[model samples]
Target: MRTIYKKELARIFKDKKMVFSVFLLPVLIMVGIMALVGNLTSRQMEDIENHESIVYMMNEPESFTAFLDASDLHMDVKSVETEAERDDVMSMLKEGDADLFIEFPENFDSLIQGYRQGDEVPQIKTYYNPSEDYSSSAYELISNQSLEAYRQVLLSQRVTDMNELQVFTVNSDNKDMVVQDDQKASGKALGMMLPYFITILLFAGAMGIGTDMIAGEKERGTMASLLVTPVKRKSIVLGKVFALMTISGISSVIYIVVMGATFPKILGGDSGLDLEITPEQIVMIGVLLVAIAFLYSAIVILLSVFARDLKEASTYITPAYMVVLVIGMMTMFTTREAGMKDYLIPFYNTALALKGILTSEVTMAQYGVTLAMTLVLGGILTAVIAKAFESEKVMNL
Candidate 1:
């Protein structure tokens, strides 16, 4: 077993191209893609914040105009009272040339001041293009800041005693209002999507390595030579499967490390991601990751054994890869808790476990189920592969 393992490692290491593809390429691709997305997203947000979108006001109120003049919103507002002028502004909004239009009710200020019970509420209608990003952002800023401030001002002006209109304040000092769990919060964001990427990455690496190590060797007649040795068929299977698992394990660590270190810095910007992984959680993640690697490797290697050549093996594995991707993606938006019974399923359990670990939500029993079931299934498949190896018809071309 040791000899076969050492020989396989030597043969793989001798191929520099394979080593680079299996290990280093994943790091570079992850870094490059994350960096590019981060820069583009940040730049877009900054541009929107700094942009001065054109705003048009109809039926202008003297008080509102004065309020706008006194404030520091820096909005560019145009007064278009004529029907023809309003139509022109509407065209500009649809064309993405204008952002927002505000139309106040006639006698807007007088109605607010003299309002009584059952009296009609003063209305302020806003128009903007929802399809345009600038228009949507400008609408949000104006609505949240300028319009809300004006409404508060009107309320205070209408009441004799400002104290009478006000209810008790809640968290006036806004900074201390939120009880933040930075680790848990960041984990929630990551938990939604990281499992999918990790699952895809493990299977992707295993797919190529498994096919080449088994199917490619069989096609080239190298596996036949290895099988004739004095070592038992089980040992040969163990040696090859361990070698596959080693590559899968190393690849898994590389991907997780690279993604963990860089994704926070890039995509998260100043608010970086911090996973609250204790020693125990770290150990669970490691154990779960290994179980998944074994599962993926065994699945691929079994398919490779049944194939006459690399192309035929890939044909069989392609559908399996697609199925894995679908399973991984299913949990990307998972919000509800996963029952312990959910952990009995294969690829799904791994995804759920990772999500729970990141969010600090998974229990010991869930992890136990995922680990036990995965390893048992992998061992069963591996034993099947060994049995197949002993058959003359299965080994020979």
Candidate 2:
């Protein structure tokens, strides 16, 4: 078994092109692509922040200008008084020269003191251009912050003493009110994403190597020679599977490490991509990764062995790969808490386990169930592979 393993490793290491494609290429591509994405996103955000929004307020009160002066909001605020002026502003907005067009009610002051005004956008292009970032930002700022603030200000006039109305408070200034665990908070943010990536990447990495290792070798007529060798067929199978797992595992590790280092950049600064994994959690993750890799390798190699050539193997693998990818993506949007039964599913369970591990939420029973299900499935597949190896009819074809 050791000799067969060494032989398999030697075959891969001897070929520089294979080594590069299997390992170094993915590293360079992931880094370059993620860095470029990060740079463009940051630059886009900076441009939006620095932009001087051209705002046209139709029927704006004089006091609104005074309110803007007292606040931190800055924009090229303009008034649209007549129909001709409003039409000109609308043209400018469509042409992307103007950022906002806010229409205040004719009875603005009367409606300010708790009146039930119309709260609908008139099914026209009056609020802001959804296509333009500047327009959207300006609209959000004015509607969410400035308008809300001014409404509160108007309400303040009704109260003789603001403190007297405040029998109780909401979100008080005391630090205890905002108490939170940064680690858990970070975990909550990352838990949705990391599992999907881990599951998808593990299968992807294994597929690249496993397909070529089994089906490609068969195409080259190397599989027949290996079968005819003095070494036991089971040893040959173990040797090949282990080699595939090792190479794919290394690829997964590289992916995770590079992704971790570049994650903050990918989301553009203080995006809270940090993970607070304990040593024990790290061990659990490592164990889960191993089991997942093993299951993926078993699935791929089994399909590879069943096929006649690389093309056939790929034909079999692609649908399986798509199923895994879809499941991984499903995990990201999974809002409800997963039960032990959810963790007992094959590919999905591993993803959930990974998510649970990161969020520090998986129960012991769920974790153990995931591990057992994965390992048992892998063992069953390995046994099937051995049976296929023993069959001359299957091997010859």
Candidate 3:
């Protein structure tokens, strides 16, 4: 078994194309795509922040106008009083001449004061073209400034202490009681992403090398030569399965490293992701990852053994890849961690377990069950592959 494993590893390493496909491609693709997205996001944010917006106000309140005049926002403000003038401004906004339009109620300040005293609250209408970036930016800027300005006004009238009315207040006494406060948000973000990426990488890495291992050899007439040797058929199957698992595991690890390094930069350092994964958590994640890779490799090996050639193997495996991807996506939409019974499902369990690991939500029992089921399935698949290897017709096919 050791000799067959070493031979399989040597054969795989000797093929430069296989090594690149299984390892380098996933890393390069992930890094390149993330860098591009990060650059685009930064540029868009800069554009939104720096660009001057033109705003049209209908029946503008004197206090609001004074508030805008006091702020540092770069805006070209136009005030219209008559209905005809308001229509003209609306036309200008529609024609892209103006970025945003704000229509205040007839007696804006008086209405707000009245509403505070138990009268009907008047609504402020904002208009912007959703199809235009400048319009959207203008709306965002104006709405934020207006909300803050109004909040301050209300606070001044009602509250004695400004600190008591602040939106976010820190309770320093219980701060340390929050579990992994610094990493909680970042972990959830990573949980939503990494599971899908790792799942896909496992399947993709297996697809390329696993197909070529058995189906390619069958097509090239080299598999028969191996079968006729003194080696046991089960050892050959075990050796090939081990080789596939190694390559797939290597590719997945590369992907995890690249994503972990790039994701913070991708989010522009604003995402407070403190990737402080504990050594124990790392071991748990590594164990779960290896188990899933073993299961995926076995599935691919079975498909490749049944296939006549690489092309047929790929045709069969593509749908399996899609199924894995769909299952991984389930983690993103799921609001909570897996229950006990969920650990029994194959790809879904892997995804749920990964999510649990990332968000620090997994229990010891859930992890143990997931790992056990995956290994059991992998063992069953390996036995089936070994049985098929013993059949002359199946081996030839």
Q: State which candidate has the highest lDDT.
A: 1
- Candidate 2 regions with alpha-carbon error over 4 angstroms: 69-72, 81-97, 106-126, 152-168, 261-269
Per-residue lDDT of model 3, residues 1-397, tens digit only: 7787788788878889868866888788877887898889789989978888988888778878877877867988888779998888788788888898888889887776666566676778888887788888888778766656776776687668887866785775675666655676778889888888887777888888789889999999999899999989999999999988887787787788778887887777677788778888788888887888899999999999999999999999899889889988988998754689998888788878877877788888988988999999999999999999999999988
lDDT of each: 0.85, 0.80, 0.84
Model 1 quality (TM-score): 0.88
Lowest summed lDDT over 10 consecutive residues: which window, candidate 3?
175-184
**Worst ten in a row by lDDT for model 1:** 268-277
| lDDT of model number 3 | 0.84
Weakest 10 consecutive residues of candidate 2 by summed lDDT: 117-126
265-311 per-residue lDDT for model 2 (tens digits)? 67766786667678888788777877877889999999998888889
Error of 3 at 62 (Å): 5.0
Model 2's TM-score against the true structure: 0.84
Write the candidate numbers in order of decreasing TM-score. 1, 2, 3
Best candidate (score: TM-score): 1
TM-score for every candidate vs. truth?
0.88, 0.84, 0.82
Tens-place lDDT per residue, model 1, 47-154, is 998898789999878999999889867579889888899899899999999999998887777787779999999889899999999999989988667899988898
- Assess the local accuracy of residue 341 in candidate 2 as a C-alpha lDDT between 0 and 100: 75
lDDT of 1 at 76: 90
